[model samples]
Target: MPTPLAETLTQLRIGNQKFLIDFYQRSRHLFARWAQRKHQLPPDKAHGLLQDTLLDFYDHVADGRITRMPEDLRAYLYGMAQERIAAHVPAHQPLPAAEASRRQRLLAQFNQLSTDCQQVLTYFYFRGYHFEKMGGKMGFPNATVARRQKSVCLRKLYDLVRGGYEPITGEVV
Candidate 1:
């Protein structure tokens, strides 16, 4: 009773490993090339974007957000990819003076963080690593540990930026 796309979506939702594997194999290279050529993203970034897009697609199907079969699955995926790319890549315009100063202050405070905190934040934010990957790289026992560490580090950074502590004196500033 179901169309091919509906069946595919059902398989994806039910965690059909073979179907997922085939889908990834069929889509990955084409999507990567499209991302690189259309968006001018580097190969590594494009690949990372592809991973994120696929995960998002899977989540949508699993969560019933994408219940109906799209007219064209590839186009649907590409649309999601474009949205992801736009969200992550900032515009090239220069910042306002005040914003620039704020960013400078943030960077200074960022530099004052512990090396472990800096690395955790950098890997999670700049590199787009999930907590599991971050845990392996940072030698945390599990993703929960990595996630907790990131939360703690992010809170520390926020406190520093909010002037909760004096950078030099460790006193409230």
Candidate 2:
């Protein structure tokens, strides 16, 4: 379903992913120059052209090259292809009404947590740090303490999210 030029752009992007990240320092310039020359257009125009060309390239070659590619290169090529596609396509804007409401409620519950709990949760969840690593950074001896603290914090978060509960009868109104 893709044009031939699109297929070639995909191949070039796929090939370029090899070698070190530092290696690309010079190659990026080369790519820019090549792109300019090939398209024979001004800067912005060339960029737009490059994006479209890359998309066409990716549409056909995606399955063919993906399995055989090296890990780093595969990641890089996939990223480039995806970016090219994304450039022309309008991005999805904002959460839906229900999602927005849910997110707001979740944020309010998170804000109600104690400062220490908030820090712990942010480091572990949002920052993607492991429990052991967070424990080391936070001065806990091991993961167990960090895990325990996370559990207590999560329980408090649950209570907040559930809204006001009965103190004695423990039933939702």
Candidate 3:
């Protein structure tokens, strides 16, 4: 039988593997650990760092970095995971002018949306919530409502983008 730490590491490895297969699903095991760790924060800065590291691992699952890892090879698997996460995480690099301009334009358009619309859109897209869950959270009966609302919001956002709104000065782009 493996040691307690070994078992935990194995679970972590298994989670990373599962994530590689399907990134859309949230890892409840990891989330549970994070919730526990969250309660121990301030004094548990190390736990916080581990949580951050594990989140990066979740990102790796999306990038297919966790398939076929053998838990017995502890050092190698951990190193591989670290490498994969490092590659997947965004670097603190400067954005090109064109990219920066595009981002600014997008942000300006996004800002034009109503607060509720923005939240729904964010939850649906950025947080990767399914329509059913999103609708329930937003108090809609079903995914159909969520979908319709999303479409409406998207159209408004598209119009704002096409209309070319400007940031800072709130001028038309």
Candidate 2: where is the Cα deviation over 4 Å?
Answer: 1-93, 165-173
TM-score of 1: 0.45
Q: How well is each residue in 1-173 modelled by candidate 2, as lDDT tens digits?
A: 53343333333333332222333443445455654665444555444444444434333343344323344543464356356545755423344799658756666666667767776776665445788997897778899888887887777778877884322122111
Q: After superposition, how far is residue 160 of candidate 2 from its true place, in Å?
A: 0.9
Q: Tally clashing residue pairs in candidate 2.
A: 2
lDDT of 1 by residue, 1-173 (tens): 43476557655554444555566677777777897789887777776776667677776775578776678777887898899777874423344789558646776787777778877876776455899999999999999999998998888889987876554333111
Instruction: Indicate the residue-level lDDT of 86 in model 2.
Output: 56
Model 3 whole-model lDDT (C-alpha atoms): 0.53
Worst ten-residue run, lDDT, model 3? 164-173
lDDT at position 161, candidate 1? 79
1 versus 2: better TM-score goes to: 1
As a TM-score, model 2 comes out at 0.44
Off by over 4 Å in 1: 1-3, 89-173
Index of the highest-lDDT prediction: 1
| Candidate 1 lDDT | 0.71
Backbone atom clashes (below 3 Å) for every candidate: 0, 2, 1
